[model samples]
Target: MAQLRYIYSMPVERIVRYFNDNGFHVNKATANGLLSKTADMFENLYTALGRAVLEDNYISCDETYYKVMDRTGNPDALNINKEYIWAMFAMNLNLAYYFYENGSSRGDVIHKKLEKYKGTVQSNGYAPYKSLRGEILRVSCFQHCKRKFLDLQGNPDADKIIELINRLYQQEHKHCIGADEWTQEDNLKWRRKYSKDIMKALKVALKRIISSPEYPPKSQMYTAANYMLGEWKGLENIFSSGIYKLDTNTIERLNRYISLSRRNSLFFVSHRGAERGAIFYSLACSCRLGGINSFEYLSDVINKAASLPPDTSLEKYRNLLPDKWSKK
Candidate 1:
């Protein structure tokens, strides 16, 4: 039973090795078989997390790559497919939900998932997300803008960009009333007072750098300048509300497990296996965010899941969610 919990936190091969070291021999296939049999429980838990995230007023979207092993039609050929897993997290709710298309991370999946969403989305400058500018409030990631310049260290132009961005972050820190205590009204007022001017100055600086012939088009400074200028409108959207975050760092932090899992496990054997992995990780991370003991929560949910009808409505099991279940 305890070994089942480890599956979400580590690769199955590690779990099998741990069991073998402890005088029990288990194979990777058997470990995955256990997870596969409990697919209903994972799906139900993921559904609950999804519902919670969707209920929030602010969301952060981020994506990371995962590898999937694709069995080609030609018997002689084997292909390792590159796939993307996207996470849409609710900042206020401290919940996250993940999704992966069969093998693609294009605009269609973005459109389908967020079609009904109607709040500010904080993400890096991805064109698919940018396309939703009119449909939803698009807030750019400041960390992304800073990263572009950070890569060009020692360049005078890049240093200037980093310094200006740091100053803007300093204003945010200065205006924050207390640790996580700033109310929406106070945040909006503080941004208007301190951040608006910095944003205006940044726009001017970016335009001038981008227009200058001193740097070639292919140079990092030119690229950084162009990125910032192109994303200016979305970046300025930060000033529209105090509730909007400067970056998607919150959700990005949640991605460490997924990234680590990819590195350890290498690749999912099939598309269905990848989806199951997504479901398990979603539940585990959401539990961590909600301060629930995921092992206990999963045990309880698994017991309850056994009694549920095949077509159980996810809404009916909402109480099983980490936040609500933890209260019990």
Candidate 2:
């Protein structure tokens, strides 16, 4: 069962063929059955997760594009567009998890983050979150804001704009890094300066794009310019509040784990199958964070959870963890 986790893909018959040709006796049905059984174990883990966590947990969400072939047997099936699926990861103190194939919009992800959330909410500046219209504490990521400018670093006109954006970022970052004993007037002064510079840069960049024939038709300039133009208020909103940040680095890091599974095989035949893969990925990510041996922990978790009283299994599992939980 543990060895199966490392196997990305192979038909059961191929493994059986290898064994048979090598004088081993593993049969076709048995190999297929074994695969199904291990898959079921992950499905069980998914069921266990839903009943495990309490309300004090954080569930951060984001979405990305997923591709699929149309079933109509067209020759262009490979190039056809499919749905955009969402993957939502719930992060609490003890564990983090993944749930997949839900809504995929800027609105849906933010809506999930805002829904019934009572504690601090950490995320990127994805517009729909702004309409959340609540007092929930939002901590955006500086890494996210900095990266937008970073993306435009090599851009000709955008290089100047990146510097301007960085200056705005740094002005607020200075306060975060203990630069101020600042007052309302000081903040307003900085904001007005940032807004004016942002407006000026946008005007210049737009004019340059309009007049320049040398610009690439689909280029970083438009991406950078449009973002600054559309998100100027949110970018400037950083200085107004002492708490709000410029991006959502936490979610970005979280994204790497859940998303890697998507990239590995490029597709899952069903959301349920993806759900099982997500459990393993979530566990792998959590184990990485805690500096535990993921395979050993998973083996221990699966082996032990199988024997514990079903009523107290999750509790028993929690107690067995090396981090602040009790003995097995």
Candidate 3:
């Protein structure tokens, strides 16, 4: 019931009424308790998911804001502070992990979380992402670059840039038609054969626009060109591996569920409450990615957790992961 409420973005009051109308006669307090306890039951599984994502060789990352209510004051008073929820997605494994850090979005927070991670991280050109340890290779999102020029549609230079970008997307679309059957090496060869020339042309066009005096330094076209040039190396890294995506669109789409929940629930009553939401979101989104029914997955796992000993091994908990559980 709690999973359904959150997954569907139905508020607790509505969920409670739904049960009462169906003759279950449950109250709001009972519903809230069920939701909290259910999240607690899945805490261990959430940790295992995080470890899996961090250990993977490639992942995408993004963050969104949530309003966390301040619990240090009067209960009736409105004391909301803006907090961030960070998401990390392992594409190859079909797993998603979410985390909260006392509402901090600092560079050190990222460094602390990913200090030992030695893999490619895909994200937008967030400044903090650039400060990641030398071991981590950062990949910039093309959609972000396109959006900058997309906003300046009236300019001829912006139009030309858009045309070139569309051509690149067209090549990607063609490659994607039977992408599932292609090996990583096959993908690499395809991109080298097709995408290499388009990217070279894009670089040349960006350089031409940057040198032209018609577009002022402060103009949107100039800024967009400079932005692409600055991220040119990271953008070019797409050719480095076929596993990397052209954009962080996968994780960005995953983040919309968090946005939807926030729109419905408004603010969590405490930091712990926000943490609980993170756990549920992680599992639910992973299940959705794996094409599993979240309610069945959660229900079975919660029951399995109840049957297991408190001192169960980490391997046992890992077996309950979405992908592993789906195979059963």
Which candidate tops lDDT? 3
What TM-score, computed on C-alpha atoms, does each candidate reach? Answer: 0.92, 0.58, 0.94
lDDT score, candidate 1, position 55: 78
RMSD to native for every prediction? 2.3, 7.3, 1.9
Question: Candidate 1, overall lDDT?
Answer: 0.79
- If the candidates were sorted by their TM-score against the true structure, best first, what order would they fall in? 3, 1, 2
Clashes per prediction?
Answer: 0, 3, 0
- Give one digit per residue, the lDDT tens place, for model 1 in 1-328: 3324333556777788888999998888887888888765567767777877877878899888889988858556678889988888888877778887886788888888888887778888999888973458888988899999999989877887888889878888775645577787898888888876787778777888888898789977889999988888888888888778788888888898887778777888878877877777677777778877777777778888788887888886777776677533
lDDT digits (tens) for residues 38-146 of candidate 2: 5565554555543443243444444555444343455554543434544444445444455554324557655664566565444555666556655555444445544
User: Which 10 consecutive positions of candidate 2 have the poorest summed lDDT?
Assistant: 1-10
What is the TM-score of candidate 3?
0.94
By summed lDDT, the worst window of 10 consecutive residues in model 3 runs over: 171-180
Score candidate 2 by lDDT. 0.52
Higher-ranked by TM-score: 2 or 3: 3
Choose 2 or 3, whichever is better by lDDT: 3
